[model samples]
Target: MKTNRHSLMAKGIMVLLSLLILIFIITFAWFTPPEERNDAHGVSMKTKAGSDFEYAIGFKTSQTFGEYLVTDFTNSEDSEWDIEDLHVPGKMKDDQITPVSYNLLYDYQPIDITGDGYTLIRPAMDYGNWKINTGSFDYSIAEANTQYISFDLILRSKAATTLSLGPNSYAIGASEVEGTTAKPDGSKLTGADVERKSDYGNFSRDAIVGAVRVAFLGFDDTLTAESYSTGTQDDKLNHTPSLLWVPRPDLYLNNNGNDLSTSGWSLNTGVTSGTTFNLQSQAMNDAAYSTYRHQYYNVFEMTNPNDTVEVATDNSDYVHVSAKDTEGNEYHLNDSVELISLDKPMTVQENNEDVTYYYGKVRVRIWVEGTDSESRRALSKGKFKFSFDLTTNG
Candidate 1:
């Protein structure tokens, strides 16, 4: 009787195990179903010279049942397409369940530009003998099974000024090279082009790697103190120190060529129209009052009872006068004056009011120097409006 009880107990245990396994299988089928997958697509485009190009991607899914989750597309580190798997669950004959995966191949329209989505991908340069390439960021998407889904992409070039580096002409593959150098065998050298693909969006794969080297660096005029010579002066004065001087006139004569003893002018001949004078200086650190001479013409303007004076000098707006050594090499003077007028003055029988005038900016060009006077010495083009301060010689 005990043996009979053992056999019956063993049969009951087997039945229980089979029931459990059947239940597990049914539960899994109800919760998670297989999804239809999409086929991979390829990318190719033809662009115009100096122009931007675009392409698009399109996808479709099978009819799905229950709730469907359509996620963003993701990209591989090197490819340019979005891919995802579909899943479905529940009864298929009733509305509770639906067909999962469908056809693998579909139409993918070219975006107006490059890359994925409606975003633009710009070329780095013009379309010439060179090539252009750029990379996009990685992205991803998730979708539910047993549902029909679609992906649409619009590509175009970025706005102007967006393409300023790297290749700007041809589309290159992994085997192609970029850069301005050549291989030892005299062939051309190039750089790489890689972008990530995902549903989340896009990002740059790496920094741009190559560009041609330009020859001339920008010139800083303020930092340059230079001068060229006439046959009278040396070819040009570089950062020379001996040219520093502050110029001022020491003598003045009247229209008759008679020396005027006073430092200013007192006019009677129609308000002495020539009493006003202009002072100008050269750019140089070592300029002195002794190194230069002055020549000027004085004129007067009369308005009824008041006389206005104006002075004219040799220094014009465009002329730059510099100093030179015995050899004629032009040098920068800390200061040099183009004498307009001197201490001598014209006798005026009437209107003697003094008025000061001002003109033009003071520009200087200097060099790096260590000597006391030579240090920071600049040769400059200087102009001044005469301050006609007339203290009535009571």
Candidate 2:
């Protein structure tokens, strides 16, 4: 009887052990397998050209645009992009951009003044579209999305060459010599003043020179010598002269392709000059240049503030990426990116061969923190109204 009792006890102990092992196996099976994340993303692209003047005189302005692969990202506290290798080698396909139309818009004041100091000013607006042609895209062995491959093209002036001063009217100082007539003092001068005094040389040499000066120097024609301020004409209205950037061929090499290829530009950190990152205000308080302090505005952060830096404003804004968490599915901000899409102004230089070119790159310099995969998908698109303006430094 004692032997029988021992066998039953042994069986009970073995059964308990088996039950515990089975329980462990069942628990492991119930847990979900680690998520299989594939680092794949679908990217879409669009392009636009921005400028105050869509065309020059009667000449239609044009620019070419394309995207390169970026792959090298500095995994530091602050993200940095290394542009040593501009193209991505492993990616079979590259991002392609369709030919974008560059629409030009401008506001200008054309002045006509009478001898009596009465000025008539007419403000005009213009529009034009740029023609884009795709070029060769080379690849580099840099990390994906970190390597940059630049695509560039030439921008030709294709407008019908319309006259700024139409045929109906002659330029203020360029008119042909008409007959001279009455003078400002109502006195008849000797050189054919009997018929028309509007001749190019009809007025005193000073007056003719003054008219030309006024036209180009932006002087107020209505002010007479007595009415004008005493300070050097520049002192009273000391505004830095604005410019229209015209590209020169000499500054850059023009190959047989008639195109210029550059490593292009990536986002440069800090306020280092010549960086293309857009400007943002932390809404902090400061004293100097306060008009632009708190407000958010577009800035080119270029080396030369005197040189004209043009931007396209028809469609520009921050693109926010967001997604929802699986648990609470709480949507959160993933990334903040800004791209400045504008018609690249041709760089015009003196003592250089003038070649018209249109080329620009969109750089992302600022990335707001807290960005993740899910949030990026949620806020796939965001847009703000944009406008292009002119700035000059003396």
Candidate 3:
């Protein structure tokens, strides 16, 4: 009877061991495999399965100006001119001067006056046998004859070679010359007594004479004097002037034997199994993209391509990357990032057989941070290329 009790006890122990094993197997099979992670230089990539197959994606960038064209203006005349004949004063026609057009929506003052002053003045009287003392004469008497002309320029959007001066934009000087010439009685003829005679007539004697100077103002805060002969005028105003409105960066994704559509850089992948994608960017020209402090953010969204059903819509799904300067220091998304790299590798898994296909979009946003006054005025404008490598492992 004792031998029979021992056998029954052994059978019960065996049954308990079998139930434990079955439970363990069922629990392991119910849950999916844990994701694998890899990191390099502070950048991390996660995937459900190891990447075995890889393919490179090539991206080419082409820059195109907005509806308006950025142009440079040049003055055909010299900086100074000699007005020999008063009848025909040295005239700088509107055609000779280039005008700026307003295509952007920002308020722009093309020309700024920096300084105004007379450099030299010489007065003479055209009276016969009327000897008068030069130093004794009142110079203020000729002030009425001296008139300054100014142009009221306007900015308009039209296809033309040159700019046109607005209506009633020009101010004409005094037509009649007014000044005192020596009289036979050794007296002075003043003011209205002067006639509208010849250029140097007795009525116009002692008329103000001097050289008037004008120049293009510097756009920068220094307010430097820019001249035409030295080519500083064109350098300051025409070449690569600060843009008032800069457009956003253009991004594109090219896959195997597929190109981007006119609609944008949106990509639609037909892969059912999980996939991995690699990202890289191309540097743009200095003229096109100028930024003192640059920053970037990578946004993503997952949805059903056919049904427009949303899948991953939270901020957790998005990843942030940064650009490095000449030094090896890393910049945050909120800081300037001149040279950027992939923040992290992305991994997508199949939730259901019916939802085999994953439709998603990757968007990149770039901006400039203003740390100082100079950097605040700095703008970012350009077209850059980004390459991708998509690998699929089922």
Q: Which predicted model would earn the best lDDT?
A: 1
lDDT of each prediction vs. the true structure?
0.17, 0.16, 0.16
Per-model TM values vs. the true structure: 0.13, 0.14, 0.14
Model 1 CA RMSD to the hidden true structure, in angstroms: 42.9
Q: Could you give candidate 2's per-residue lDDT for residues 28-82 as a string of tens digits?
A: 1112211221111111111122211121111011211222222321112222111
Which regions of candidate 3 deviate over 4 angstroms? 1-218, 222-232, 237-246, 249-251, 256-277, 280-394
Better of 1 and 2 by lDDT: 1
lDDT of 1 by residue, 257-370 (tens): 111211122111111112332211111111121212221111122123211111122232322222222232212221222211111122212256642211111112111111
- Give the alpha carbon lDDT tens digit for every residue of 68-174 in model 3: 12222111121111111111112234775643222111211111011111111111211321111132221121110111111111111111112111111110012
For model 1, what is the error of residue 191's alpha carbon versus the real structure, in angstroms, after optimal superposition? 12
Candidate 2 weakest lDDT stretch, 10 residues: 18-27
Compare the candidates by TM-score and give the number of the best one: 2
**Model 2, runs deviating above 4 Å:** 1-41, 44-355, 365-394
**TM-score, prediction 3:** 0.14
Using lDDT, rank the candidates from best to worst. 1, 2, 3
lDDT of 1: 0.17
